[model samples]
Target: MRPDNEVLIVGAGFGGIGAAIEFASLGIDDVAIVEREDDLGGTWHVNHYPGLAVDIASVTYSYSFEPNPFWSRLFAPGPELKRYAEHVAEKYDLTRRMEFGTSVTGARWDDESGLWTVSTADGATRTCRYLVTATGFLSQPSTPDFPGMDTFTGTVLHTAAWDDSVDLTGRRVAVIGTGATAVQLIPEAAEVAAELTVFQRTPIWVVPKIDFPIPRAVQRLFARIPATQRAVRLVNTSLLEMLMVFGVLHFRQARLGNKAGALLARAHLRAQVSDADLRRRLTPHYDLGCKRPTFSNSYFRAYTRPNVTLETDGIGRIEPDAVVTGDGRRIEIDTLVLATGFDLWDTNFPAFEIVGRDQLSLGAWWRESRFQAYQGITMPRYPNLLSLNSPYSYSGLSYFTTIEGQMRHIGRLFGELRRRGASTFEVTGEANDAFLDEVTDHLADSVFYLGNCAGSHSYYFNHQGEAALLRPNATLTTLRAMDTFPLDDYRFH
Candidate 1:
């Protein structure tokens, strides 16, 4: 049977947006984008807490092809990012093709027809020739199930879904979790809250953020000569690459770089907090790169405030008007905020159920066997399916690097399919295994393996104890491979 559209993208975020632009460039216009959120911008739209900004430099976080010349700061705030997403969508004419407020439930592939039937939450189904799941890695929010949480009478919030209507001023607030989100939020909350208590399960590695506003003259220059911005982007990418390659990935080979990074973070902490006991409690026990490290100018200083109390003692239970600690200490609060990160390995791996050839469930296969994907894009049995946010797909610290690299992969792979006049393409099991093994071997020397990460409650290591989220390679290497990977890696029919 003929499909409803040539391509069906399962997200409207940067990943899905990049895929749409790439396909449109390839003369493929019969496409549709489905977003679960009310609008686009994915994470930026969903997360609008007091202190929401890109951790990576603004120039590096955006698409290299479509650089925004008017970013207000070095690290653009959440609203600016949302506007950038809108601009990209409008420029590419992808806004009209997007269906917002639509949740996809599952999808099934038909071997006989070579078509995929995607079921949505509204009991509607759409058939397409190619299926691309770009649901993103952080789509599902995880809320800690502390005892007596339901009985809490005070206002509750999750950083992923912050309620702006509720006034935080003069409110007694308790924040749970100290991941990247909490690092950005605690300072902002401390500024307004009458009293703030932070519950830390693990102390994050905090580095000083080098942030400054972009001058108008510089913005105009970038707008006039795009090459100037591209040059700046290259410099930023190179700096981040050094951190990822030398300080993290090559932990065994470049232990000095890793140790330097840890020292820098410790020095930053020492300079910010004068209290020795507080500094010790805030210092991370694991390696610098074990968990995701974040740069912040005020996160450390927030703890120095008199109204803010750092609670290292574990949470015992939640009461109606207070949080009881493990040491039997009760801290009263009018608001409860959960900054617990996302559930990546479980519900977020695929984001939704996907059945491929031989009735192989994508999520189940990853859990039962291993989370493996060919070049982090395709699986052995998943014909005509492009899993953009698959295992080992993320290439660099900047997510745009990964998105653009995947775009190149899509372009090259589809170019080959068109050359052969093929309708169906599936990666050979040999190719999948080979790619998985290559990446696994490369990660053997990474901080995930070599460094002390026993105390890091990191989501980087999956349930099977594999650091399969990031592709252990330089950004340039990953891009080059995307451009020139062997076309014979897949069988086309």
Candidate 2:
């Protein structure tokens, strides 16, 4: 079969862009990137809420290969990230290969043709020699199923789909969920809304954000000497590595580090919030590293405002004009903002139908058995299919770190395929099982297994209570493994 493209990536986000860059580096230029959204930038393009910004420091949030020396702040805002995405796409000449507003419904691997036939929502089909699903972990937004949500007369909005025309100034707004997204948005909403009510399902670990503007001189220095920026990135990455490796991943061996992190967050809360009762309600009961933490200088202080009320009572139900708590108390509000996060394991694991060898559905197989990806990229039956956002793929604090690691994996895997003069490659079942065992053993020392994570409804843990989201290794270690994983583990055809 003559394939339309050598490679077809199912996302236009950073992950897809990185995969395309890797494929190009391997001298395979026939690539196409399809995005469901009308534009690139993935999350940056889809989310445009008031106070959206990168949770990690700007120095380490981006790709190491294409470092942007002109970040305005240490924690750059959402717009800057969007701009950075645009810059990277243009610089890499990836824009020409992207198909915006193209929603892929499913992909099926043809045994006879040895090509992946991708189906789009628009009834179009494209067959490619290789298919890479770069769909992000948080692509699918989860809306709550409240009893009376259909009867809500007031304007409702999800953080994923923010309507800017509807202003919150002087509006009686009730924001639900207190995750990372809400932490950044609540403070901004509190300043403008007449009465802001935040419904908390679980209290998040909040630490002070050491965010500040980078001076023009520093930017110039970074541009002039790229090595200087690399040094700063290295320093920042190391600090975050300590937090991830010791404070989270190795909780059993390094409990002190985790406790210290918890203490820091508690202290930050105490300093910002004067009310002891409020502080008690705001503090997370679970361990600090159980759930993903956020850096916020104003989240705790937002509850101090007379206009902002922290509602700890579980939501009983919703009415057209007010929110009824489990205690039977009702709070009237004009706007309802659902900061409720994404559906990960369910809707976003594969994000779309993927039928591999012998008509084995990727999502179904994972659900019936267990979610496993050999080195977080390949499965036994999935020949020439690279699931970029698979379980245990994410390494380190920054998403870019994960992307770069996968890029390295792609480079090595594809180079071996070329050397063998092969058109398709699939991971051996033994290799996949071995990798699964290794990661599972490594996670025994992690916060999910060793520390108290009972109350933390973290996305890290799957339905089977396995914390299979993160790679559970030091960032550097994961990168090395990605580059050096045994090529013999895959059977080239």
Candidate 3:
């Protein structure tokens, strides 16, 4: 682990593997890709809950550069997605260059040597010229400080850390949170558990999912004629872009699109739930697209089941054998399932010291200025360190779109390093300021700020109450910019 390398990639998910492949393509041979898990796949490797599936369509969510011609469905399950990651790893010969079961504890830049001192938990350290963090936004699981959680005698589990061995059959299961994961799991939980109680803090808009298996013949055709698969991907991407235009770009269209979407959701809810009281309880008061909209057909139908119970009073406290709601009802349960979301905006990321120029830790910098980066890639003071999917770097439906932009951006930086015969480069403060200012200018047009999601507790907004997670730009716009973006905005030394 003390071996020095030219580049170090942390987290072997979509971002990390993609970075390694891009770097190698650019003749950057000396690279090391590390994963904390015993295997790769990051989130896909970790979250193994029941009824898990991708919300976004499979074609768009996957890598654009390396297309999977034979996806089982339009939206593949978690294991299939993980298999795709593994497929990419093997295809690109990335497995040979990866260090599994290794966690990066800290990264310190040595100004004199122009190398990043990357420290691992195993008391090992390596100094490399370039550092790339592909540690995903949804990497860390968020479990709230539920009162008396430790005292609970029965099995308690986060959806991210699902225990398959736990006997959900005939057990009274209390599921906490009603976000995307909750919606997906509730259907499955209701089928197995004797009594299923889903605790809802706030209702999220759930719409009908458009999903069906890709026929084996079609898969064969895609495998044989690559153009056919490309056409399918193009159509999927185009459709998603249209949604982006209506929901994320234009104000008037966004408003209309949201209204139509809400109407559709209401119809779907009404169709599924027979009980008027239950339907009313399930209906969301907030505007559509406030939280990340879920795509599920089975979720609403689960509420119609006799075993299922939807609790909207909110949780007051958690006792040893029961959960007390805000309405003072102590619902007894043998098992607890936390479909709680990830720690994206409020996470203590890296959870280790990252010292850059002037001994400035990234933790301290973020504390001062909430997660600002030059095009969400490079920071002002952190030289030769690139974040693959930082704040203000979002694009279309899936993260693969961001990875496509980042790959191009990373290539450009490396190109500059080779062309100018420079050792390192850091983003200029002026450039960082200008980039974010543009983001602010365009923020007013998007649904995040214009319509309603800002008031909602969506992870799209940060702890400072600013919509800092997503960049207000089209996917193509971001991708084209990354192709030959101004390298002069960085100080090459």
Candidate 4:
């Protein structure tokens, strides 16, 4: 197990799995995928909470290479996604190349040898010519530091790390946060809980989800006629891409378009909920596309339930058996669920600390909360290291699509390396700075900055209040930029 490897992939999510397959296809057999969990699906395997599902349509969420013609619903749930990952792994025989329960602690570049020395939690050390970090942006959960959280008599669980054994059949449940996960879980919990109280920090814009069962006949047709399925996927992907362009480049156009979208969403809420006050509270003051828009058919209807209460007052503290609001009001609950989202920008330096050429640590470079990457793949001083779904790589469309594009970009880089007989390659500092300047300038006019969205923290932005996460365009533009193997952009050894 201490043998040298060609490439080391430090995750088993969709991105990591895709990298493994791509590397295998390149005739690189010494590739290894190390997953901390027991299975291949990273987020899907961990977050097994109630009413967990994908927001994107099922067809678009899947990998482009291997299409699944057996999706049961437009929005697939967590279990089905996990099964899909497993099926892909089995089909590609990726399980044999993966080492489960092995967490990457840190990775350091050997300056003399131009190789990465990776360390694992199990005290195993290995060196590889190239290191691929496929750890996803949404992989880590963000659990707020609530005072007296440990002393609470009732159980508390983050939605991403749900404790299923704690039954909520007849319990008084209190859900904290009103993000996408909260909207999805509230409706399901309202059906079984004795009473449900949703604590909202800031109201979110939610649109009606047109989620429906995809009939077996349609699945059969998709299987029989691949052209029809491909056509549907192409149309959906293109529409989303166009919407992203409108959101980023054409602000006036996006604002006008969002007004209609907002009116439709608000009207749907008004029609679903009878309480005028509740409907007003649910209506978002900002534009629809400012924050990540959610889709839920029952979220508005759930607020109308007799046993459910939506509280907009901020939380003060957590009492023994109750939650205290900022206005000195307390609501008692039997269980607490934290639907707070993931830490996208937080630094989780895996045990192997990455040190670049000048003995500079990646942590040190990003200490001021500035994330800089050349095309979100390679760093300026880091040679032979690739990061999938890194900073500025997240797209408005499906993440799977972005990851596929990045994997292809990396694949092309590897081909260029082989053709040139280069042992190591790194982007020049001038090129990296130029790319970052362009990205920051593009983000300045985007909706995340110009929109009149209040109380929204810049998770997508860095410490400098610049958007460092989302990509400007959709699949075609992104892939086109990545398609050109720009060997001139980097310095080779």
Candidate 5:
């Protein structure tokens, strides 16, 4: 297959957009972007449910290169975030290279020609010298296969694919699952619905969030002098990075911080709920770092209202118009909401076939061997393909750091590639093995493995009981690796 473009990015999310903009700045303009959705923003455009907002501080969540000085709130909502993403797409002229509604179906690398032949769902084909897959792990919406999900027929809604058309003002609402998404949407659901019932599999640790509106004066100052916003981003990022290092990666140093955070959580719970049993039901049983902690000031307080009910008994089955608990108790409902998150493994790289050397599918390689990559970018036997947001690549706190760090690394790598006039390069098997070994060896000291993930229901560990999702490195350490790591570890030809 002949090469049609220099680079092809498989998503239009933050990572993809960041890649496009960075490549453009590096004078690589022969790029093409393919998105499956009609719009540009990836998850932000799809998830428009009630009370949808970022949990991370807005100051550090945005692009480091293009910080928005006029964020209305410290925790920006879904609409504003979608707008910000669209604004970046327009600002960088990224839409000119975008092919929306075109989902990539398959990609095959031709070792002889040194190009990737990518096919789409629309029966079209294009080839590129490099393929950058930025498809996020959480892009797919997962619907729990209840015994009678097709039987109820009520207005069923997944938080990822929320339907605002159904009026919840006077309807009985029942929400299932109490993960991060459920915590964010539960408070708002209790407000508008006539009655709200939340089904929880397990209690999660929560801390009070200090979200507020950014005053106009501060916005004016940020716009007038961008240095102020940069400083804020830097300070908050440094503090939050500790959550990754001391909190999750190295649990030994997390003793003091965990005690302080737990004290605050206990105080918040005590102050919010009056009933002792209810407080006990709401309180988490595991350590803070066992699972992904959430930040919400109102989740605990929402149950204090008269219209809300918390159900802890496990689910048995679903009837035509109600849910049956394990003890044979039936709870009637007008709507069923599923806050169940996406299948992290199924949608890891989208439903596509990627054939590498020896006609081996990337999916089969992982299923047969293990989930790994060289610094979460390149893998052995897959030449000229970069998988961003793969296992052991997340920044732990701020995704912006992950995005910026990865984009800079990829840009620098290709810069070196073009300068040397190399047709292709692949990570050495020894290098890939050593890198993954280092990550797994460090897991002994991390909270995910050492402290335990039993009943945590976290996506951090795979089915093999291996903690392979998050990187155990500090933020600055990852930045240094991305910036100055030796290219000799890879085979450039």
Candidate 6:
């Protein structure tokens, strides 16, 4: 394939789709979206496991510009989300500009040509003036390297990359880990599996999902009156923000901070499960907000089922068709499901190499110092390169809002470049360093640091025990910061 577009976007997730729409709205037609999967909806297309759904309510989860008043439920399922993504792509005519089953292996910046050279896994090469990486944080699945995993005769799968062909009906199933994915899938699997065993390394704080279907009449009302829907969205967003603030600022204020959340979660557990020991096992030991809190009405209830078993004894290793526990106990199973989550902070990519200015690799740069970007979009050395939902860009609020913010930021930068007639625009070293310092200082006062909570090995925190996954503020703060591109903060040439 030849170089065919001015801008190349990798991954067809929310960020990529948002970028494409934003650019298209700005009358930039020479854009190409390359997706590794055969279809759109990057993570939604792949993760088709049982009970897969968005944790956030559908109203805020969707695109703000293109509101879906017809959402089936408060928290939409994966299939519905995938269909919504496809709908957006078709509605905005993005499908024609997208190349399916095209995986970008590496992207290198050519200084002389002032363009990006992108290489695919199939040895096909293409070039573009700008490269936007939207390879979402959860795009990669982290399958634990269990001993004798390959030797297992039974089917093995990861929740993120679930195999639909493998039937769980009447089959003995063993699920590893009790993270978000496992919490959702375990309930569904327990209903079908003849015998189900969940091996939980640590307990997770569970809250009621409070999900319900949006009636057709309500959908019609929202469609007829958009302001009403916006009002509802604002209300929900405000409530969540207040909760986050309370959890962060007053964490140690006795019954006001994490204690309140813990009490609510304990009450929820009591209401859901009848067994006393099971309820105790389900209660979390750590601070409620230290890790991502799981929202589920059925997860704890699933353990009350006759066939389902919750094993708190940590796994020692995998022995063929059984999971050996640390306490000399083993649970035999015919299928193993690993819900170990993704390696979000592990920026290692051996197969792909990105050579920035002065032959500096992005991996090497991030390793030397943590990943730093101006507005989480542009790095100092990588000119004309933008990363959507990059490090320190995630939010407790919906990710769609963050993607929109980044897209706007990129659009403003492109506008600035076009108006100034600048061929290449790169963030200055001084500006990047100053921004990093500001972000670091802000993070120090945030909940990730001030909360009376000891950290664990979560995707939210990197190896350095710093919360690199999420931005420590509301969506409005991020949008205001990136609403304009400060040309003075960057170098032109």
Clashing pairs in 2: none
The C-alpha lDDT values of all candidates are: 0.95, 0.94, 0.85, 0.81, 0.86, 0.81
Residue by residue across 54-92, what tens digits does model 6's lDDT show? 988888888888888888998988899999999999999
Q: Candidate order by lDDT, highest to lowest?
A: 1, 2, 5, 3, 4, 6
State in Å the error of residue 215, model 2.
Answer: 0.5
lDDT of 3 by residue, 202-232 (tens): 7878988999999999999988998888898
Per-residue lDDT of model 1, residues 377-452, tens digit only: 9998999999999999998899998999999999999999999999999999999999999999999999999999
lDDT of 5: 0.86
TM-score of each: 0.99, 0.99, 0.97, 0.96, 0.97, 0.95
Q: Candidate 6 — worst ten consecutive residues by lDDT sum?
A: 248-257
C-alpha RMSD of each candidate structure in angstroms = 0.7, 0.7, 1.8, 2.0, 1.4, 2.2
* Per-residue error (Å), model 3, residue 435: 0.3
Q: Which residues of candidate 3, in runs, are more than 4 Å off?
A: 1-3, 348-351
Better of 1 and 6 by lDDT: 1
Q: Model 4: per-residue lDDT, tens digit, 1-493?
A: 2338889999898888898888888778898899888888988898888999998888889998888988889899889999999999999989899989998888888877778888888788899988999888777788888776776898888998888888788999999988888888999999999999998877787877888999999999999998878888888777677666675545554677656667888888887988889887877777666677778988889888899999988788898899888788989987999988887665543224788778778867765547777887888888988877567777656888778888788778878878888878899888888888877777766777777665665356555565667876556767887778467888877
lDDT: worst 10-residue window of model 4? 344-353
> What TM-score does prediction 4 earn?
0.96
In the range 339-388, model 2's lDDT, one tens digit per residue, is 99999988998899999999999999998999999888889898999999
Of 2 and 5, the candidate ahead on lDDT is 2
How well does candidate 6 match the true structure, expressed as C-alpha RMSD? 2.2
State the TM-score for model 2. Answer: 0.99
Q: Model 3 TM-score?
A: 0.97
Runs in model 2 lying further than 4 Å from the true structure: none
Model 3 backbone overlap count: 0
Q: What is the lDDT of residue 3 in candidate 5?
A: 81
